[model samples]
Target: MEFTVKNVEETMAIAYKLGKFANSGDIICLNGDLGTGKTHFVKGLAKGLEIKEHITSPTFNIVNEYDGRIKLYHFDVYRVNDPDEIEAIGFDEYIFGEGVTVIEWSNYIKELIPKEHISVEIIKIPNKNLNYRKIILNYFGEKYNYIKEIFI
Candidate 1:
């Protein structure tokens, strides 16, 4: 489904709603350019998970784990040079484990992402406004098909 938000707050609101459906072993793939607010959405996701830790983009660290209603594994794969880098960091352990994983700049790690993942693509509307964002959500399986109900 497609959605448009006028500002950052709306982006977070949508993300928070989607995050509520997060379950163990859920994979959320985020694709967007710099300053698109992927990290903000992630913070909102953590908020929905009832996590108390401060959220930050894990660009340098690759992954950030948080304690919440369920474990939240947030990954920023932009700096990753290769898929092997993910394997070196034990990527499978997080995705297949008990946590909801969100990967930013996931296009870099495309081959590593699961087939049954939820894809969120954010695009900035040119010349519209600095904060305007168009978000597209696509689900791969019935498990996350409920996204339509909450993604609005």
Candidate 2:
């Protein structure tokens, strides 16, 4: 589905709603340019998971784990030069683990991403407000078919 938001609050609100449906083994792949609020979307997801800690991009660390109603494994792979680099950090374990995983700049590690996962692409609207964003969500497997309920 496609959604447009005028500001950060709206962006996070949509993500927050989707986050409410997060379940164990769920993987969300995020694609967007720099400063497109990908990390902010994660913050909203964290809130939906009832996580109280502050959320930030793990650009240098590679991954950040947060405890919530369910565990959250957030990853930033923008700096990764090779897929093997991510694999070296036990990428399989976290993706297969008992938690929800969100990957920013996921396109960089596209080959490693599971076939069944949710993909979110955020686009900045050109010639309009800087905060405007067009978010497109695609589900890759039957498990995420129920996400239609969020838009309906």
Candidate 3:
């Protein structure tokens, strides 16, 4: 589904709505450029998952783990040179484990993306006044078809 948000709050709200369905083993891919509100969206997602602590981008650490109503494995591959780099920190186990995973800058390691994951692409529209964003959400595989239908 495609949505246009006039401000950051709306973007977060949308993310929060979808996040209500976040469950164990759910993988979400977030694609966006710098300052496009990707991290903000994830923060809202963490809120939806009932996480109490503040959420920040896991840029330096590569991954951040949080305990909530469900586990959240948040990753930032911006500095990753290779997908294998994550193996040292248990990439497969986290993605396939009992937690919700969100990956930022995922295009760098697209090969690792599962066929059943949810993808969110945020694009900034260049307009002097609005700082608008176009958020596109796409879900792959049968497991996500239900989610797709609901979002549409």
Best by lDDT: 2
Question: Estimated TM-score per prediction?
Answer: 0.95, 0.97, 0.96
User: Candidate 2 local accuracy as lDDT?
Assistant: 0.93
Q: Look at candidate 2 and give me any clashing residue pairs.
A: none
Tens digit of per-residue lDDT, candidate 2, span 13-130: 9888888888899999999999889999999999889899999999999999999999999999999999999999999999999999999999998989989999999999986546
Candidate 1 runs further than 4 Å off = 128-130
Q: RMSDs, each prediction?
A: 1.2, 0.9, 1.1
Better of 2 and 3 by TM-score: 2
**Comparison by lDDT, 2 against 3, better one:** 2
> Cα lDDT of all candidates, in order?
0.90, 0.93, 0.90
Given candidate 3, what's the lDDT at residue 58?
A: 91
- lDDT for residue 96 in candidate 3, whole number 0-100: 98
**Is candidate 1 or 2 superior in lDDT?**
2
Off by over 4 Å in 3: none
